[model samples]
Target: MSNSFSDMLKKNFNIDLNKQQKAAVSHKDGPAITLAVPGAGKTTVLICRTANLILNHNISPDNILSITFSKASARDMKERFNKVFGDFIKYDVKFSTIHSFAYFVINEYARLKGINFKLIEGNNTSLNKVRILKTIFHDVNGGYVNDDKLEELLNTIGYVKNKMIDISDYSSYTVPQIKNFNIIFNKYEEYKQRNNLIDFDDMLTLTLRILKSNPYLLDKYRNKYRYIQVDEGQDTSKIQNEIVKLLCANNNNLFVVADDDQSIYGFRGASPEDLLKFEQNYPTAKTFYMEENFRSTKNIVSVCNSFIKSNKYRYDKNLFTRNENKRPVTIVKTRDEHKQYEYIIKKLKQSDDLSDSAILYRNNLSFISIAEKLDKSNISFYVRDSKLHFFKHWVVNDIVNFLKLALNNNDVQAFENIYYKMKGYLSKAALRYVKEQDNSISVFDRLTTYPDFRSFQIKNISILKRDFKKLVKKRPFEAIRFIENSLEYGKHLKEYCKKTSFSYEGTKTILSHLKTIASECNSIIGFLTRLDELQALIKNSTAKKNNTVTLSTIHSSKGLEFKNVFMIDLIDGEFPSLGSIEAYEFGQVEDLEEERRLFYVGMTRAKESLDLLAINEKNEEKVFISRFINELEYIMKENDEIPSEFSAWMKIGMIINHKRFGIGRIMDIDGDIITIKFKSIGIKQLSLNLCIEKDLLKAANS
Candidate 1:
């Protein structure tokens, strides 16, 4: 039967199945889970298995339901199925997202329960949704504890909802803020119910509730979908997994395709354990592993495999590829952001197809800087999932610019921006006087004697200067509070909101993100450094071109493949992020593991070439690269330096003996330095040249 199936695949689709793919498609009975590696042709197996169930097993097409993570994925599945089955494909065959399928089951039969529901437009932006929460939780005072807090609460609610936690069990929450979130969460849920509306998360919970209560309806669905195939099952939340379970309860004919190592959406309530422990959930379940990658080069796959192997939570599997391109992944180190941009432009210019390349980052803040540099170099690029420019907020812009100026008195661009925005604050003549003063005196110092300055304006300026000085020497949160109180930024936002009819809630939402970054930083200088990093990426409104390089966040780059992928800002505190600091400090190993998985996902997005970038600080005390990549073997090339094979000798996970630190595993590389975690002395960075000269390092392979 398997041979015949393979023969049919070749005849029909003009494609030959590899051993792993063949094994995956032939599994036809009971519950089965396929742990598919990236670029392993899982989609092909899914389509073939679905068609096989219909053609060979005589299962009706209407009875076989296919579920995917997104609408785009569903569309791809549908298009692929049609291409394979052609006119023989049934129109009733369903290809829908888990939420959409759940919505259908509830909306169709929910009328029997005397419930006629209308789904709220839950697809609105985060800020827009916060605006809705503001209206719902007015009793909390000041529209739901600021936008960041509200956004945090929203995330907590989704987390609890995915866990199927009852609102009465608030004590189950270990986090105090989530407990506070629980109280408002109930009110928010009640408000939605009162409006006869349901948000996206509600689609999963409500559908399960209705199905469990109505056994007759549950049985109908169980009978309807005799064969269920779930794609990207690693991203399935607990509630979503339960829905699939109940629908397949009686038939137990389920096929789930997932890569636990590719599971990077845990922040959004996705639990890869649902796929990992499939057999425990369904005793009859069988499992298959697909590890042959057909997309990226063998070297690329090896790096990704080695990187993810450190993760303790993933299924144990080895990913291999046939393409033997041994072009070592390039590690490009620059002195600063501008130099990094120059290196990227140089590479893009050499590329045969510009659109086939991409520049991915850990955060969206880097997008503005990269895009601007690309534009300046006459390189066109597109930003994926483009939102309204953060600088577009008139009131927020003025305040942040002022903060920037305070952070760095030499920031002339920031000075110009605030000066233009605050029309009534200073006269043009007074501005000219300050600008033309001795270069040694700061702008605020020059503002003291400007004759045209209003007395009241001078008073405000005096307070700003005094407080700004103190803030520079203070902690991040302290500096933030000083700016808030001294500037009365909230009051200014209110006035701006009234004048332009802006969503105050949205503006707050935007500011909350900045505040989170500020609070996490250690010192005012550190915070200012981040602020500068973000500011460099501000959207340049003047340059508008469609055919350009693609800039995207790692999370947004899932399911996307690029020929030449350049992942920037591979620094220690940035990629794994400062968020990982909290997790590491708290010993939340799972959170740290997810960060590694995110790195894995980012690395696997490349098909041909992958460049991991880092900037060696010139004036800084120490240079650091991400611990995630310390072990991977790659070539290291400093700006304008010839590439060397130094990294080829050292590999991640290989035990090496160091002089003072004893035996340890190599962890990361940046420029000429390599970091290793030693058993005796803990993690330390050593200069590669120094290590070799002193005979302090020994690679396990050697």
Candidate 2:
């Protein structure tokens, strides 16, 4: 059966199953198996392995299950299988999300145990918990947390059920400390159960609840899933992995694929540590090494190898490639953040892929300077995620136009355009809340209504409310006539015409797109609802190609690939993240490793090039260089691996002096930005030639 399966794969993929792939495909119906550190062909192998089973091994595709962390990746697998098998395959391939798989278990098992199985949409987010914590638990009870602390808490909840960290640690304290956290954590369950709402987290939690309660459901599913494959194995949380183990109980019938170094979703409870434990759980978990370099240039891969090799207990692989290193991956050390932005723009202004090119950074804060730089350069860029949510942004024109129209009445076309623009993010309930004039449902209201505001609902409501609110303010059929010629709508249309800002115009353009959309939608309301779904899918489809260089946080950069990745702020405080000085009693050593993994993520994003950048303040000068550059320096000095110009030019520093700011030295020298240290302000960017003169380097050269 395995041989016939292998033969079919050979006819389709043009490659027979290698020893490693054969083992993965032919594994006896066993509990769990890990395919460790395999290469570029892992996905292809998984697909073929499945095809082999369905075609020859006689396992019904319906009985086989596969899970992945992303819908996009799942879609990718579906396409891959379609391409190879001609789409006529009839096996029931249950390639769903882990949470979805778990939900199926509870729905099946809980019912047999006389437990009423309830259906919950995992994506529905409720703001009740955040609001409760803020008003009752956090402030009225304790106090409020700033954005960073809030982000940490959100990241923590995702981590807890995974058992990456224990919630019990916070149990010893009470009032406003760890005890307060426990109190909130305890209430989370109460809130979810009471609302009967499931967030993304509740799926895993409830699945575990059902499993513990019903052994019968467990047996049914264990036998139901004859073969299971998990992709992004590095990200499987503890509860998730345990569920898989239960379903595959004592059968080596499960295969897992992931790269330990690429495990960037740890903030979301994905622990790579479990990948390390596959051997203890499944003895024949053949660790295959796919060392062929497919994604990066040799130079980029080499530099990355040095960095990740620092991690212990890693599977050693021969990750060599026939692809030559086009250029030694360079570090454009910046003297400061501003300089980093300026230099990146100057260098990339003429690059072929500048529109496709990206400037990756440690945080969104770095985007401010770069966005300004691109704006000044007249370069246009759309943030990968925020591109379509044009209405959500504080576009002065959109706000003024919509507010004016609503204040007047249902002005012709004005309401539709605004509704069209907004349909991208607003949900139906929110639209209803606003239409009902639920002054209670502010942006704060909509945001908090669900764990994550389900996208479809928001648009459905925002568009309707936007219209109803206009009518509510205006009133009467006679008022409609008045609104038709109302000076307010005319003024809004006039203002829309008068607005010269490109961004504002972009909003207008979307309205025109919406008008066409509205034609199909028929009513202002129907078109708006469908328009919401269309705009969101378009936004998520792909990164827009525009001349402006993009700068985004690494977290936002996930599931995205770029041509050039510039990692700025590679210094200790910024990258490893100094974090809330409060959260770290000693300092974030873990945060630093996370930063290192972040850097790894940024580096891996590139197919051709990667730039490691950093900045610092010293002697009133803004000094910037790759901290990795220093590590590179250490390696070069130790091994005599330094390139001739690199040793001298890499060490080169210059001075920029302002009469008021005093002397500052160059910490980095990217094209336009020069890092300078001034006597009073310490280190910073002195916009090249803005209020500065170069000195130290000229003298040194002479």
Candidate 3:
């Protein structure tokens, strides 16, 4: 509450609080927000302020509650408190996650009400919730369910819960997904109630309900946790903020440490709006800024600060670090993934310590080959991903291979894949004979003309030929249906399912999805092309690694500091991710902002040096460097292979779809000059990069 408390901190903890930190710690009343920048001494201020409240203001340890983001953070806070105060924090000083605290209050209230309820962990309980929803969907929709659809339903449910929306009010929502989410939510709630079970969300929902329902209990909690501190308050959801408000109603002794620029969890339903509008929520609240960064070098900090300055939705604060005269952020251009891997290997070899360096990506799929290369090099790294072998699913791969074959008749990879898997029906010797006869033709076509082809094989080939002809004339679904029946794919998948213990229903679900996609296609070729694009997009979608040279996703790299960070795959579609910009088309502005914040988070993780890597093209389609790269206040290094200023981002033969002119392919790109052959508008010459900059043309596959 006073400067004397700062003296106590200095004397006991050996921490002389900085001007901004001291101001934060001394503010002892009402609601206050400490806008702590990345690497700022937020935890120190939080701990010191809590200590100041307890010691100087004579606040009881029992009345103090500190809510952080995760269990690990809670533990770390407690550890820091213990180290700072030693024996002073002995009795009932609450340091727990918001969910944990909610569970505690809800469970206690349930006991007082003589209600028998089981608090279920959301992770383990999600499957049970899904089962209930799946059954309801099966009955309601006449049997249509799949993992992807169910996951979407789950996300919708999460959205509603986080937004504190009533399930019955779903019809009033404009989003179609929310309406479907409402249907699933109602049934799911009934199932939980019947089983006397409460999920993780129920903990917050029920706690809030109890507090609102019983004034006595609300007052009890309000008085009990008189001093409340919330960390990472920028990431608080609507429900979380409401719950916090209720707990702090009587005392109003609230302090929150947040940075809106660091609020990157909008996709998870957490809102920066909560932090942005905190002043209105607590009108008497005072705001403090902690702009000094203690981790990253001045150059690294400058780049991150400048990068985030573009976002109009965040609090205005520039992060400044103490360490000056460090290397400016570098933009490295590589030819391909292999070249990227080679650069990483060279860096690792040159580095003094492996742990000091990190190779961060937008997603896990980008590092599958890189991880393999590391493994071959005997480099140890940590990655968290599904061990389910879903990537190796026999039926899944078979279906994708078939779709690939339909896209390109001369897809040798698909031919080899199908030949090996269906060897029992189509002999290896027969495939060889067909290949020797005419290596240029598709194996399916070659099977028909092969001199020694068996009658059964000939029948299957005829089925393919019949479907192939129909695909050119009839709807695309006919091709998929014929392929399935003629090859007896369902029967084979069932056998494979039995052998691998893979779910038979999953195969059915996949077929259902395929049929749905096929129904939207005008031609088999068109469907194949779209499917290929979708698959590539999915592969590039985010999902992690750690050590030898720490490989990580930008999401996973938060709250971490590295001596050197290599932010790879900084291409438009990959870095910002495929949907961030497109979400703007759907009027989802916050989605794009969150993506920006994510890149900022990745940039700020570097302590001494940062390298942003991008390649010119992937899969023959030009990959634009992230717009963030251009915004950086530093010169980028250009490799001999890459054109000056990343001009190769708009390459010749790239696919473009004009809104007015229809689908077109680039014939040539000379400087800003461009030539395109539009199927509907005929040949047209337009400025290449300038057309994209003006939004006159968009990459079809982006």
Least well predicted 10-residue stretch by lDDT in candidate 1? 635-644
lDDT of each: 0.73, 0.56, 0.71
TM-score of candidate 2 versus the correct structure, residues matched by position:
0.64
> Which of 1 and 2 is the better model by TM-score?
1
TM-score of 1: 0.72
- What would the per-residue lDDT of candidate 1 be over residues 1-702, giving only the tens digit for each residue? 368878977987796988778778888878999999999988888988887777778888888889999998999988888888766666556789998898888787767767777766555544344566766566654443544455566777777788777777856653334424555787778877876767778888888988898888888888888889999998889899889988998878999999999888776688777877888988988889899998898767877777788788778999999897555566666665556676788779987677788899886656755665675567777777654445444444665676677778766667766653432366667678877887576677788778777788788668667766776776766655555555566566667767743556445545544554565578766765765554454344223344457888898889989888999877766767656756788887777788888888888999978887876541122457667656554322322221222454566677888767788988876656788898888898877644533456766556
Q: Give stretches of model 2 more than 4 Å off.
A: 1-39, 87-92, 109-149, 164-166, 171-179, 385-550, 556-560, 579-591, 617-626, 635-702
Q: Using TM-score as the measure, which candidate wins?
A: 1
TM-score per candidate, in order?
Answer: 0.72, 0.64, 0.70
Model 3, span 445-516: residue lDDT tens: 777877776788688777765555454454567766655665567677778768843456556545544554
Model 1: runs farther than 4 Å from truth? 87-92, 122-130, 143-151, 168-179, 392-547, 617-623, 633-702
The deviation in Å at residue 103 for candidate 3 is 0.8
Residue 605 displacement in candidate 3 (angstroms): 1.1
Which ranking of candidates, highest lDDT first? 1, 3, 2
Provide the lDDT at 292 for model 3. 96
Model 2 lDDT tens row, 1-702: 366666756785687655655666565455444443323567777777677777766778878898988777788888878777756585446567887776776666556666653444322534544554445447424656534344456556666766634566644321123325656676765766775655567678778777666677667777777778898787787888888877777475777877776666665766567777888877766665555556677766666667766555455544545567554555554555556566666667758756567777765544433553565466666554433333343332354345445544434334334543432444455344445443433443343354445666555455545554654454232233233233233334446535522223233333333333333333333433553555454454356665646667786775466667777656654555544222345653444454556676677677676666656642123433545556654543444333221223333365434555655566754333456665678878644323212222232333
